[model samples]
Target: MTFSKDEQPKNIPESNTTDNVAVPKNFLIPFLLLSLKQWNMHGYKLMQVLLDLGFTTIDSSNVYRTLRQLEKDHYIKSNWEQGEEGPAKRIYSITEEGEAFLKTCHSSFLQYQQMLQTFFSIYTNSLFPISNFTDKND
Candidate 1:
């Protein structure tokens, strides 16, 4: 079947619902640092918390890499804790600077949400105008 570049094959779905959409891994940095602010945890435990919080596709290496970058950037601090039966674990906690950074991130997130809301409103309204969705009784 020949199809133009702008067209999709008949069998393909046009849009994806929120439940099936995967959030990009880069979006988790703020969440990770916020969790650390609540309590210090090693990288593995942080990964587990992320998975529990619905970031199902997160990679351990990426988590560790982000943690390292956060530490290097002075947003977080870590210390080695002795383990009874294994190597010492590095536990991370949010620094004072991290708290300030988080506040900035929170503001950005709010603005981003508003931008998305505006975009979606225009997109859906364009695709399915209000008149088409109105109730017959009204």
Candidate 2:
């Protein structure tokens, strides 16, 4: 059966829920704020960074929505700059509050990493039992 580019399989079911299925903005917001803390960037640049970080399925709308929410929360501030080729772009920068929040995020990330490492260590040890045999002469 030939299907057009926009067509989906017949067996697939569609949902009527209005809930957003995209990745939670909370996850990306901290990273966005952290990135902006390093340097100011517009939406496109932010999108590129997110893509480079392996977030290929992120929607542009979600990115903009997160940016707006961050701005509303006072975590980020934006300014408009006229570009030579196109319309003005809104550049975002992290605020002092954002920096503090990023610090907390960093700590949480480190703790998460440690927990994952511990889990892997236990799993590997259980999966492969290593034995150390002593010589009878010794």
Candidate 3:
């Protein structure tokens, strides 16, 4: 059968669902540890930091759960500080183990970044040949 250039490709299938599943709860541990590595913070401050980092949909319960897991794993330690105006807050800090783990995560993230750069370079170059062809006259 003949088809126009705008027609859908014969081999590709269409799907109606596009909603993305949530990132797993455990996924927040590394981020929490990394944040704590920079400074000791309470739950609210940590949540604010995460929100500022673009995690606006994160639930408070998830943050607290991750905090508990991190403490259980010995990656973080927390202490209660009595606030003058309100209830005591639990301040979290990264333990030595957490620092080491953060280093490993940082290295892995760097490698992943390099891999993504290489992949995109090849993929985009192949997809758009004109991207590599510069106008020398300019």
lDDT against the true structure, per candidate, is 0.85, 0.81, 0.82
Clashes of 1: 0
Please give, for residues 1-138, the per-residue lDDT of candidate 1 as tens digits.
345657867654456545645566557888898899888999999988887878857777778888999999999999999989899999999999999999998999999999999999999899899889889898
Report the number of clashing residue pairs per model: 0, 0, 0
lDDT (tens digit, per residue) of candidate 3 on 78-114: 9999989899999999999999988888888799889
Better of 1 and 2 by TM-score: 1
Q: Ranking by lDDT, best first?
A: 1, 3, 2
Sorted by TM-score (best first), the order is: 1, 2, 3
TM-score of each: 0.76, 0.73, 0.73
TM-score of 1: 0.76
Model 2 stretches astray by more than 4 angstroms:
1-25, 131-138
In candidate 3, residue 125 scores what lDDT?
A: 82
